[model samples]
Target: MSAVYSVKEIYIYPIKSLAGISCQQAFAEEMGFENDRRWMLIDAENQFITQREHRILSQFYPQISDGKISITFQEQKHEFSAYEHLDNPVQVNVWDDKSEVVEVNESTSKWFSEQLGFECKLVKIIKPGDRKHESSRLKEIFNVSLADGYPYLMIGSQSLDSLNEKLADKITILRFRPNIVISTEVPHEEDDFTTFKIGDVQFKNVKPCGRCIMVNNDPENGKLKKEPLKTLSKYRVVNNSVLFGTNIVSLNSGIINVGDEIIF
Candidate 1:
């Protein structure tokens, strides 16, 4: 399918590793939203647990209110105030192969366990005092992010609807771990959007997003299904990445809205 040249929609997930809220306007930095995905969940060993491995995480919807974060799932919900400064935090590993993280407190840990019915802890990464983004490919681009990988992952709305239509069951769009959601007038046009502008910001396409089991999780219900992933595996495979959305590098930073017009 060919793309139509127009903007349709935009969205952002405030908290990482949980269900996201649709946004009309969001501030964009080089990596993504200023605080989006800035904090994460780590296991006992401080290893990062994500939707890719833990599908149940998709069930929780997270929202930020008055400097606090509230998470809701099933019939249970909880709101916790953000710590101004965590005390006695231990250094932990976010991944087995990459990323070390600083742990939060046990009070934060109990809050998450109550919500998810599991023993887990919450932690925030202290922003690196001295870190730099030296992309071997895009040397001129400034990369400053707390994301597990890459600065931003943008997905087209039509691309998701197209995928869900193929499945016999209705699937929510949250399965794919995207940082930005854009609606383009052209059907399936985001696949070829090399350069596009949202508000005053412009983005350069870096590569096609690679997909994984994360796409199969039901964000609202936290259930694992096999049909969609099975279907996508048959056709969407590209190199090593599953090839769903397009990975983009920021050209200009600005605010993007849900109804904002995208210029291609």
Candidate 2:
């Protein structure tokens, strides 16, 4: 029975470093959830840029409807196709892993670059698994999206609950940007789960997600704070890295819904 734990939340970031969209249910795929981290912003050098360096990136939120994505910055809004044209294929470096992606369009590219006050291109992966996972933590390699690494990230609700007890001002679960959140009696329980199932899809916990200063970014204001990470380092640090959630890879393609029991 898939009853030990249940899915509490599902989230997807259409563009890397941008605000995420919450969903009641999500499709599971080898690379990642559909439209999750499929698009990214790259500098002139073709190196991927993220909120880590420019926190304001989180202020731009994307919403998809009828195969189109719209992002509003300041007071202006622009829309682009979810799957941009494949004719403008380009090579990009997502932290060392090279992948082929397509430039969205001239209009959207100009809009974003003008708003961000920098010369950057909006790119989208034409297909799933465009970028292969490059991690020594796992023995086998699989495809991944524009996410830092891994296809999925799962965190227990209690983990944030426990962490909030130590924080002076608690942060939202969105701060962790997990693709899946399971309700569990214990904090960080997903860390020990090697193999599990959420709804109809089987998943494997491949590695512990090491957090960085990105966690310090305030989801609401796109401002940086010292709270969560500063407090987390005291108790969660291991091997010079502060660990929080578990990175996972789907075993098969299926549907994962909120309230779906998590079987371990």
Candidate 3:
């Protein structure tokens, strides 16, 4: 049979809740895309900080090249090595999961603090396997990065197109922050995808992603708008939560490209 859908875009958020990097290709790791959400910001209490709390975070753009990761904010740039060794392992909280993370360094932490105007530290997940999925609904244990939950999120491009048709001001897929964007003619078809393959990697669709206020934030200017969510809630609300996209877990490891065929 001919391919029903094709991969349209791939994204990786090296730092949780920060602007993501769009790539032509990415390696599918057990936890998530390689170098994806491997680094994150934590406050003095070692609690994870996200765009939900600080909308300014959306203004910080990240790029990964060679062995270095660079972030640009307010016309300034900061770069750090992809790998670093730290002497202390600090306990950090990501939602309900607590895991030990290695602090990047005092200088990196200072840079972030200055950028966000708050005391925060940059930390990396030393061992992703140390933080396993805690849901009992799944029969197997899986490793995950600092993502809200699940290792992958796939959304049908047509779904966003459908949602846009209902709103006066349309939005882009970046607002949903999906890792995998599949081009399909049908809207919301991914919600029915239980198991599927892209290239040689297999993935299982787990649950519908519940929308949050963070989706209303303008990725371009870090400004909040009472949109998409307000309109989405009119029709997409379920169990009192606005729903869009679907969370997935990788069943195998491989590389996925932008134009690869999605086999269901």
TM-scores, each model vs. reference: 0.81, 0.97, 0.96
How many pairs of residues in model 2 come into backbone collision? 0
Per-residue lDDT of 212 in model 1: 70
Clashes of 1: 4
lDDT of 3: 0.87
lDDT of 2 by residue, 18-37 (tens): 99999998999998999999
Q: Point out where model 1 deviates above 4 Å.
A: 1-7, 87-101, 114-119, 126-146, 185-188
Residue pairs in clash, model 2: none
- How does each model score on lDDT? 0.65, 0.89, 0.87
> Could you say which candidate leads in lDDT?
2
lDDT of 1 by residue, 109-155 (tens): 78777765677777664453212344444565344454545567877
Q: Between which residue pairs do clashes occur in model 1?
A: 4-186, 48-94, 210-242, 211-242
List candidate 3 segments past 4 Å from native: 1-3
Candidate 2, residue 67: lDDT = 92
The lowest-lDDT stretch of 10 consecutive residues in candidate 3 is 130-139
* Number of backbone-clashing residue pairs for each candidate, in the order shown: 4, 0, 0
Better model by TM-score, 1 or 3?
A: 3
| TM-score attained by model 3 | 0.96
